[model samples]
Target: MALLREEDRQYLENLFKENLKDKVKIILFSDKAAGSKLVVPGRVECPYCQQTREILEELVSLSDKLELEIHDFLTDEIIAKKYNVDKIPAILFEKNNNVLGVRYFGIPSGYEFSSLIEDILDISRGETQLSPTTKAFLATVNKPVHIQVFVTPTCPYCPRAVRLAHQFAMENPLITADMIEAIEFPHLAEKYNVTGVPKTIINEKVEIEGAVPENIFLEYFKSALKD
Candidate 1:
């Protein structure tokens, strides 16, 4: 059985035909067993890895410009280390074989699905939908910044925050943004003290608790540099 509904598949087919431009490569890393040395002890088996793969397969089928590459989390240790992926069900987007900083550490379902679509379009076009002010601010960022947005798939507001962070990555090569599903990565949720959804941790220090606007997000982005 396909994870995507017939209507949804049609919608995506139309969307890709109209919006997708250049070839977009989606690299996925997953394993049947979720536990790894980096994950918390006794962590639950990856509840969404199979579903995530299904979704990617469906998505790639919608467009000729989209392609999927699957890798095992444990067996492909060398490749995972090269991309710095420490978790299963991780996704990395690329264009013309050049990987970008946009990443997802969990299944991008529910509202986060749109984030994945927009990211594909942005990467294909080699641009973003961010405001000029935000782009200007990102240009001043000379050092590396890591942004981790903890979310649940059902959270309605989480995708905005995730997309905002990803767009920031599109603006600057120094920015790396990830959308991490809180339920799949319990240890990460505890480490970041994520009691609420859409919690964004910048540079593992500056924290924002909601889906704030671009201006406010940039403020926190600047603050994270200081930490």
Candidate 2:
């Protein structure tokens, strides 16, 4: 069965027709096996790897400018290391033949799908929807900032946090943002202590529990830089 609805596919086709100005490469790392090498020794599972590949294939079909490259996390260790991908079902976006720091650590389905679309648009345009103030603040960031927003496919507010961090990454090359599906990465969830949805951890230091306003999020981001 197709994961994307017919209506949704049509909508994305139109959206891509109007918005995409440049090529966007979707680099995916996953294990084809039912049990992935990245998982625990006794844990025989790769819950979303197969489904995630299907969704990505459908997505690339929607636009000529969009492309998909699939790789095995275990066997393609060198490529995975180049992208700093250590998890199965991970995705990285590339534009102008330059890979960006934006990524998704699981299947970007449901509400999070919109976030993926917007990210492609932003990368193609080489800009973001952030206000001048936010952009200005991001420009001042000299050091690297890693923003990881934990989410679930069903969460309504998760997209906001994901998009915000991704936009920050779009504005500044020093910032790398990720949308991590908490359910798909249980170990990471426990490591980060993510109990609720839209939990954003900036630089693994500053943490926000819910979707927050841009201004408040900036405050947390700045705090992360201090640590």
Best by lDDT: 1
Worst 10 residues of 1 by lDDT: 35-44
lDDT of 2 at 107: 86
Off by over 4 Å in 1: 32-44
What digit string (tens of lDDT, one per residue) describes model 1 on residues 49-85?
A: 8889889999999999999999888778899999999
TM-score of each: 0.92, 0.92
Candidate 2 positional error at 165, Å: 0.7
Clashing pairs in 2: none
Candidate 1, position 71, lDDT: 88
